[model samples]
Target chain A: MSKVLVADFGTGNLHSVMTAIQVVSSGSEVEASRSARKIRMADRLILPGQGAIGTWMSELQDDNVRQAVNEAVRTKPVLGICLGLQALYEHSEEDGGVEGLKVLAGRVERFSDGLNDCGHRIKIPHMGWSKVHQTCQHPLWSGIPQDTRFYFVHSYFARSDRDSEVAAVADYGLEFTCAAARENLFAVQFHPEKSRRQGLRLLTNFLNWNGEV
Target chain B: MPLAKRIIPCLDVDEGRVVKGVKFVNIRDAGDPVEVARMYDRQGADELAFLDITASSSNRETILHIVEAVANQVFIPLTVGGGVRTVDNIRSLLNVGADKISINTSAVERPEFIEEAAGRFGSQCIVVAVDARRVPDTNPPAWEVYTHGGRKPRGLDAVEWAKRMCDVGAGEILLTSMDRDGTKIGFDLELTRAVSSAVPVPVIASGGVGELSHLADGIEFGWADAVLAASIFHFGEYTIAQAKEHMKGRGIEVCEIIDEFE
Candidate 1:
């Protein structure tokens, strides 16, 4: 059984993440904790966050979760979701620019005002499910087909500096990076927990994955 | 493509079971809230809203338990409403895995409550539910906001209240037409259009959804970002897949339904 630690940054839906992980990955022990030692000891780590970047940053610092996450990601597979994915970037334009964890070389950007293919004005939050186009092959993508829809709810999206790190892309008004992957880290701007069957498949893959590229 | 229009199935819960009725009368038991919610999730519902119609304090614990149970198995966006009078109530629901909280009566009583809740939690998590009814005697036949489950009408105009709620920080407006509710004729397109145009946030055109085409009309004509229904879905008149297929055929963008699990 895998020991998975869902790092609680005090912002997002920590319980839901833990619930999804436990429900999808049976036999694996999943716990949501703010403890640095527990996070370091886990086989896999999940950094789940939501809400504003400014408050998230402060909470991470106050709880010292930023350092714990940075340490855990180096030696183990780490996955970030929603604001957690954005937090892995260098900085974000949210709340007048807040510094992120800088685990990945990217910046979070807001969608510009534009009309979609339907000529309708795009909503800001980009709320609802959308298809994720796989840009490259990885263990996490196993058993999941290309262009599978995942649930997304955010105003800002991550733009990785290195195109090689982008694992998948999705279109709103324009195409943007939705999932990023590095040596031992994989982060998605969408919520896999809320993506139904495909989401559960991805979580199951994560549970079975080792810390590898 | 733009974000797909959402089709949400609302479950009016009382003391932990799912119930449905016409205009809050002639209520009938549907089933266990969690089981019904799981069925809808499997049927590919875009979202789910659970309103505790029995807002009495005695049933509050049961509602929270139901929310937790549904949230565990549903794996989709869940919005919980009824008796959300304070930030603490919103927090409790969110803690139990509710993605959003809808406020109706409290929002009308203290308009600033919308601003406060939206400010504390992000606006995306705050939904202002407006239950409105048409008043033909007015010069423009304005719709007035109703409280206590459409039993009491307030002086505030529906469109104006929707605009104010958006300005203050309501991420979405759940506009329900009391006149058209449960009648199965269709949504009040005029009222939906008025509010949709008045606010920049996404508007969920709710109530009076009987036929499948009404769902399409709510998007094509009413300019609603989403359409919500209870009776049709609860009674199994049409599956969510059928509704989405019909809407897609009508040129409305909807999330493709994937029924298989690998």
Candidate 2:
């Protein structure tokens, strides 16, 4: 029996995340919890947080999840979504420059103001569905085709100095890293839970990933 | 290509049931909220908005149940609005499964409510709804903001009001035009362009949409980030796929289905 724990550390809304997981989990055991022990015992870990990274990090520390998460990424398949993806980086420009979980070697920077795409001004938060281009091969990319449109809503995005870890690319004002892959860790800026069938397919891939690259 | 301009179908629920009309009157029954939601999801709608028009506070529980049921089955962003006044109200809806909270009446009553909710929940999920009607006999032409189901006018300029809402931390604006709502000639492009140009965040154009061309016009001319409609999509007059294809043909970027089963 596979155990999946969605990191519900009381920092962000995990209702949709939990529901989407159960739909794709079939008969697997899926629980959304903040309990540090349950988090460590789970076979797969999903760390999802939104809003500001400062509050997200503080709450993770308050709930004693920071250390547990760092340990989980080293051994199990870990998936991050939205701010959950941003928090895996080392630092961010949000909330006057906050620190992240440092699970990957990158930094999160806010999308510059007055960004124009094909002569039209692009809005901040980069809301709605856009195509996601696969940059490298990973188990998570298994059934889903390349450049599939996924739902995105954020003001900032992440970039890694280590190109090998970059798993996906998306263009708003310019192409940026939307998904990163490093061994057992895979994180995405888009919300797979809300991306409809393609999204549900990605989650199903995560449930059966086995932590392989 | 950048982010696809969204095609969001609005479901006005009264006591947990979905209803449609020409102008929020002569209500016609359209199946259960969950069933309608599922149908839209399967048809590849970019997003779904649930506006509770139920008159009394007693319907709050019913709305919550409807939201939870749809959220569980449909794997997409669910925006729930209608009578959202308190932070606790936002929390309760988000706790159930709402991705975004739209505020209309309460926001007009208290402008700071947008700031408070945005500060607590992040601007990404806070949407300010503006219902406006054109001010006749004006030099440059303008629209005035209305509240209480368009029964009262607040004397605020619609374009300026949208910018102010964004300034106060509103992530998106749902701009609805009362003058052209039931007539269905098309979206108020002049109003849409004015507000879309005034705000820094995304503006979702609502109210007037009769043909597929109106949906494309909202994106192409009105400069709306998303186009929302009712009756047309509810009555099965046009599918979201057909709408997206129409938009794509018009040189607008839209998300298309790529092996939904794959």
Candidate 3:
């Protein structure tokens, strides 16, 4: 009967994600709040964002949302999407290096070069649907197939300090990590709300995940 | 990375309600803006832009009330524009919970409005909306800019106006092709590309979308940051979920679509 809290940072596809959650996890309540102060009471949390890494982190610093996120992740199932995923890192290359929340032990860096050693031909912001190669065991993939397509629109991606944090990898010019999970924390570069069936399945899985063996 | 395709659903509101039309005329009444917004919210729409087509002429209070209702009900970022002529109007829209405020007629009539709004609200909050119609010239055909819901023509060239809007303050540009507006034949790829490449800020392509493939083609060939459509979505011709699925099948990167019925 407890409701799930979706963090609304005044930016991103918060509503789309919340609606998906509501449908996938029917009968459960969903609430959205811009203030991080309201996030602590939720049974779980969804962080959805749309903006540059630098600007999003800047606003978080201005609002002191970092601490609220850190505390929530400690005892709750937290999912980060797009800019929300980038916010989990220690820093980002956006705007010549802005510090992230450091909830995950890594940094968000821009793609260095291109696939096949080709010149910097690919666009910097990786926007669109890409195939995700699952690597870790997370209940969020209950009915989903391996290497299913998910939506993504981001320039920078997460680089975990530990190898185990990566939950899935997506292919672009070369294979890269698209989704990551460390403990109760989970994040994806692609957006689930914008992603169709696979995205809904993922949301359904997240809702059904009981955090128990 | 190829430019990501954006699936944008635009709401045309009259008297604080949603209405649709062809070529920006012969308006047809749709459902409540807030209710429609909630529907799109569930269907995995990438973004929502609320065009206050009648707010400039009357019922400013009703417009804000509609915006507040939709914003409170939906979770995605909302961009509100129509009859916005001053920085005060821009600020008020943002204050009323708009993620961004779009300006068209004002920016063309008084170019300084863009700069002043940008100065006060930052480029992120200010968006310049341009309506362009292809007109024949003695030498080569060109798209002439129109204002006040395509009723008046601005002497300035659209390409030049785009650059000027960026120079003044617009953080983004919403370019709608009047020729394409209800046709759904496809987007004006030339117009979208011209304006997107000209402005440094993000460009959202509006008008002339008949199918899902058109959205893909516009983003890929037109270089649009986002693609906006009205009739296709308003009349249930296409669902956001289906559009996203088809876009994904076409190898375009789109947001994960949450199915409405699922």
lDDT tens digits, residues A71-133, model 3?
Answer: 877778888888888888888887688888877788887765443222323433454456788
Q: Against the true two-chain complex, what DockQ does each candidate achieve?
A: 0.61, 0.72, 0.13
Looking at model 2, residue B250 earns an lDDT score of: 97
* Candidate 1 Cα misplacement greater than 4 A, ranges: A62-64, A117-119, B21-29, B137-141
What's the true lDDT of residue A139 in model 1?
Answer: 97
Model with the higher TM-score, candidate 2 or 3: 2
| lDDT head-to-head 1 vs 3, winner | 1
True contacts kept of 1: 0.55
Measured against the true structure, the TM-scores of the candidates, in listed sequence, are 0.94, 0.96, 0.69
Q: Candidate 1, clashing residue pairs? A: none
RMSD of 1: 2.9
Error of 3 at B197 (Å): 4.5
* lDDT of model 1, residue B139: 73
lDDT of 3: 0.73
After superposition, which runs of candidate 2 have C-alpha atoms over 4 Å from their true positions?
A: B21-29, B260-262
